[model samples]
Target chain A: MMIEESFVNGNSLIHRLNPVLKIGFAIIYSFVVAVSSKFPSLFAALFIALFLVILARLNPRKAAVRLAAVNGIIILFWFFLPFTFQGEALFHIGPFAVTRPGVIFAAGITLKANAILIAFIALVATMRVTTLGHALNSMLIPEKLVQFFLLTYRYLFVIQTEYQKLTRAVKVRGFRPGTNLHTYRTYAYLAGMLFVRASVRGERVYQAMLCRGFKGKFYSLHEYSISKADITCAVFMTAAIVILVVLEWTKII
Target chain B: MDKDNLIINLTDISFSYPEGAPLLNNLSMQFYKGDRVGLIGPNGGGKTTLFHIIMGLLKPYSGKIEIFGKPVREEKDFRSVRQRIGLLFQDSDDQLFSPTVLEDVAFGPLNLGKSVDEAKVIARKNLDSLGLSGFEDRITYKLSGGEKRMVSLATVLAMEPEILLLDEPSAGLDENTRASLIKVLTGLDLSYILISHEMEFLDSTTTSVYIMKDGKVFMNGDRQIHRHYHIHPHSALPHRHESGFGKKYTDFLA
Candidate 1:
């Protein structure tokens, strides 16, 4: 199964932004929005995030699809939060009272969550994962952790391919999955075999690395330099985040 | 060949897996500077294991490995040996770990202490030599089987090693790709020990053939292993004896 990195490829300005700065912007923007409780700042954050999505040229329908997955868990909050929190009753749903504070709290959470997610999708997700690894490494993340991240990203596809091969072999031999002990055991065996193959492949990969003189350090061919666009992006993101903070703290909507 | 021309010498090599039977038993082999050798063996005959030992990926229980006329024992000793000797793995997936083709090809050159631009230049040159001029930005995992094999070769070639050890370079390749592989292999100026089962491929590419079986290598000389045949009336498909041994081999309906 191919990984669908739909937002990574584009010719938009956001796509051209430096990945290191983009990661930094995403983290700060998300953190700021996460701590704000007022509605004006949250709505502003949502608007900024939407602006970023527009700048990224991402398809609106696709963005909504991604947002829907995140909101699936948030919808559970809507179910219980409106009826349980202590506040002025907004309305009566049969025997339960819907509190005003509960409704407001849930709405604030929804806005904050989506604003952060959308901005992150626009900023961090626009670059390839390998580039992200380099960016993270340049940000002073541990070399081992960056290496682990990059290697995991590279091998996830291989492991998935291995999985499909095993699934095909089992399917060709009249093996049908069902709620039975035989099916469970077959799946268990399949998992076991996949692990065995993966471990063996891992050994061979390490050997191949050593053959090429891999001495505990991975060098990247990518050279990242700050451009005019990166500087503009950094300035814009900082200003937007500062405005959000001021609107929340100083109540200057 | 003179002792001065020896590229790799493995003397008294004996290796076996833990809790398993022996594989290579006192196997002695010598590779010279200007030799294209083909190593053929049955499955589980320790062909891949031998390649690993020569590159110091695996340690032999009892052996003396001499590369470039110098004895190599410890891991540090093998580091220099690995730089001069490249090994193409049996599976291209196992060989390529980078996200893109260019990065993967440049990996060996970069490891060899080349600058980024230098490594990229070498990578592009090798890729162009292999007729893969525009595959630099292509995702490694998304490549076709034949393309992946060629790219894997490009990765090995980018290092500019003195010798290459290719493990089943043509396995699972189509006719056109296999033909291209044969052309590339024959065009190389450096020496290589090609491990393959295809007699036609081995016949066209190697100057000599060695049969490895039962933990020992027997010299097969520069003989014509590729033969033409037709489907027998008694059989359903045209097939030749891959091993070219045993009593049933005479049933090819010549």
Candidate 2:
């Protein structure tokens, strides 16, 4: 539901593009922002990405909640990077000095990451995985690869369900979380048991597929036909990125 | 009643697991086109195994099985027969694999080589006919058990098979969903074989019944079997009954 909520508000020109085209444009945009070393360029790109995110019509508060949960580890890394990397001392503390370059480098990495994250969230949060797969196939991606992507997305949920069931079963057996090494070992063993159970369930799923005439190909009703509007939107987004990049190169404000 | 148009025929069919535990032994029966037969038995009576064998999903150790008047011996024959016979599995979770309801319902038609648009039309028609409109975009995992079962049946219906094999179609449904399912099942024109423990549903929906005992056909008849078994409205199990058919069937099992 959070994912669904994140897709509710966008009416921007970029949001109107085909999902596949948006994904491609996002990939290109993220790559360009990632390799650039100029602070002004990165800052401009981040601003544009945030603007596009707003255009997507997504609820900023809901998006923030979902992203906060998923990106906790990334935020932790960002927090530690400035302290760990030593550079020219901007100021000295009891044990650590914050260097100017270190700060800039960290800022650059953070900006690049945020840009990539925004693009992905905009594309995936709005489109269902089935729609995304069909759009990719319509763009002439290999059917086998598309099938793999679809299956992986489906099984990810299946695995999560299995894990929940295992945890419940363990709890019913009176297993409680604790701080000792033995408890840690028990958790590891449960994780191993979860993998085994998932594999067995996977085999049963495969058998079910075979029964239903799954001959190494996934079949779905979702279809994507690229229209003139799709092409126009893709071209417009590309043109906007080119103009932005060129203006930056020309040192225009 | 014509014998030549018999859709399914089993003779001396015996099946055992790979470890040599027998599941079905010398079971023989014939199903005519348009027959709505209900299979009933206690647990471990090989009801599901018999259904699997009839669908050609599982092979019997010995005996001859013919579907649509053709013997099933190889994978190609099984595939052809399977396409004509739709099997609605017991677990909706096992049957409905796709992420969305529309995709899961369209899977059978698409596999049978229908184009995307054609499959969509078929899937939509089936879903709508089952009164599951507005569910096309819903995720499969999020659906309730009864809804999942209805969607699973819709998937098979999209294939337009002549024969339908349902395993416990009303196992865990509430009264409302079960009543709706009964209405749908009664309206279907295809020949159907239902495996269920719902005695009331079986009595109301099926014209004939086959009870399995010890992996063999014990009793096959019209509503008379239900009467003789004393499965009446007020009666429970272990009722007194004549022993001719029951004794013979038990002897066949021994």
Candidate 3:
């Protein structure tokens, strides 16, 4: 599965932190990482994020795989950003110029992306997505957004399977993609069919939910309580945020 | 409970879709205590629609529905009624909506305001009863059709409903799984209204048979009836009586 439900169940400290607190930390940490231009502070933020990945007991290979896709985007920035900007020319191909400022901007974006990606892979990947909706609701995020997340999470896999089945059916009929109007029209029809099916499925699912006594409000079966562990984790996260902010502002690495 | 007491009484029930043809026309029926009624019909015969009406998912245009002597009208009224009466959808995919089998089974109890731990216990008990003890953690979509059907049943049974409306429980099962389902369903003590096209499966599980045809229902007098006595599945639930209606309806065969 290219898109994975990647909650690595574990008993590590990062895994046990309150989801609300972890989300808050990720947001603030990403913001700090984004604002920093200094290499030392950016590297320090990356190290902290990596440390959390270790604390969460995530498999290194799996984390690397997740990062690999993001790193591809980062590599694209290097290709274009370093050669496009007009600045101090650091080097040259026969006709093109590689500017120092362009290289610096590209490197900074790469650092910010890596730091934020690692932080999210550690903090968010430890949560089962259904409960993440509950946590988002408890954080006083808009009810509609939470509901949207929940409904999307519930049906995305079903829709993916639907699309896969359609593709297989097309393949079985010897429909190969070429630079032709037939292939494009076929794809358009497939998309239309999927949309129609999804709409019908949505109505049926809504009716089923009503039959089960859904009263326009979703109640999470898990009650939210602030335990001592959660409290301690909150303190730890606050300390981590302070350290990150200090590094960003002070440039002390 | 009195043996002859009517559990569900519908009088002159008439229903139709908006701008569509009428499905139920002046259909009146009475389900007595312990009536294991089987509803058999062809497609578009309104069997599933009737099930929805009983579950309060659809409203009849003109009728009075009394369940345990209480009238049902709005959504709130049905909320209380649904707790005591479970409906198994024809599509197991629709019924088992939760991501995992365990979560789906526990959904009803959790909705009833039970704590997670208590709901887990009820879910496990139901799963164990259905011979699905270790299947709890399996992904809902990854399950086989038979396993999905069993898990759906477990979800309903977890609610400890007094009455069950099962729609086409054996529609897509193989012989072995269908027989296993038959055994589990037949072993249950509570009354259920089972809708199926399979006459042999219905004959094996249901005490009485009704045919839905021409926008009405009629009791089948041709099939011989067999008496079945069952012990209460749970002590906390009330005992079920062998419906007196079933006996009188069977007399039509004689």
RMSD of each: 3.1, 4.6, 8.6
- Superposed model 2: Cα runs more than 4 Å off: A1-16, A67-80, A83-87, A179-197, A225-232, A243-253, B222-254
Interface RMSD of each: 0.9, 2.1, 2.1
Best by TM-score, which number? 1
Q: Which digits, one per residue and each the tens of the lDDT, describe model 2 over residues B83-116? A: 8888888877778778889988888788888899
Residue range A1-253, candidate 2, lDDT tens digits: 1124346345765456677787777777877777777777777777777777776767788768766764676677656666677677777667877777777777777777776677677765666667787778776789989887877777776677777888888899898999999789878988998889778667666656666666777765655557787787677678867865774576666
DockQ of each: 0.83, 0.41, 0.28
Give the Cα lDDT of each candidate: 0.89, 0.78, 0.82
**Docking quality category of candidate 1 according to DockQ thresholds:** high
Model 2 scores a C-alpha lDDT of: 0.78
Task: Please give the C-alpha DockQ score of model 2.
Answer: 0.41
lDDT of 3 by residue, A30-96 (tens): 8888888888788888898999898888989988998999998888888889999999999898899
* Model 1, C-alpha of A92: deviation from truth (Å): 1.8
TM-scores for every candidate against the unseen true structure: 0.94, 0.85, 0.83
Residue B108 Cα positional deviation in candidate 3, in Å, after optimal superposition: 2.5
Scored by DockQ, the top model is 1
